[model samples]
Target: MHALPDIVGYLAAIIGTICWIPQTIKAWTTKETKDLSIWANILVLLTITLWFIYGILIGSIPLILGNLISICAVGAIVIAIFRFRSQ
Candidate 1:
């Protein structure tokens, strides 16, 4: 019943969250973010943060967990962009 949907939600969340891994890896290993847009990443992070807040309010584990991980992944990308850009 409800459990099935939540399971599906978690699966989707995992898939979505992992999508950032390659980019994060590339950004860190190459230290190259010239092609990555800071504004876009910032906006995405902001959106994910909002989703996380909403998830908290609604008590949705999937949204909360997914967005939390997303925030970290994207946050890392933002940091990478800045760290590499200044150099």
Candidate 2:
């Protein structure tokens, strides 16, 4: 019933979250932040955080877990951007 749909949702979340890792790693390794907009990433983080909270409220493991993992990647990039950004 709900199992198949839930599995699909989780799979989608996993794919979406995985997409951010390469960018995060690239940014971290290259120490390049000029092209990356801090505000945009911050907004993304905010949205994800809100979604994570919503997932918590709704008791959706996929949403909670996906956002949790995504936030790590995003948070790393954000920190790297701040750390490596040119003055």
Among all candidates shown, the one with the greatest TM-score: 2
Per-residue C-alpha lDDT of model 2 across residues 1-87, encoded as one tens digit per residue: 799999998788779887789989999888888899999999989999999999999999978988999999999989989999874
Residue 4, model 1: lDDT of: 94
Tens digits of lDDT, candidate 1, 44-75 = 99999999999999999978988998999899
Model 1, 21: alpha-carbon shift in Å?
A: 1.1
Off by over 4 Å in 1: 1-11
lDDT of 2: 0.90
lDDT at residue 55 of model 1 (Cα atoms): 97
lDDT of every predicted structure (CA atoms):
0.92, 0.90
Where does the lowest 10-residue lDDT sum fall in candidate 2? 10-19
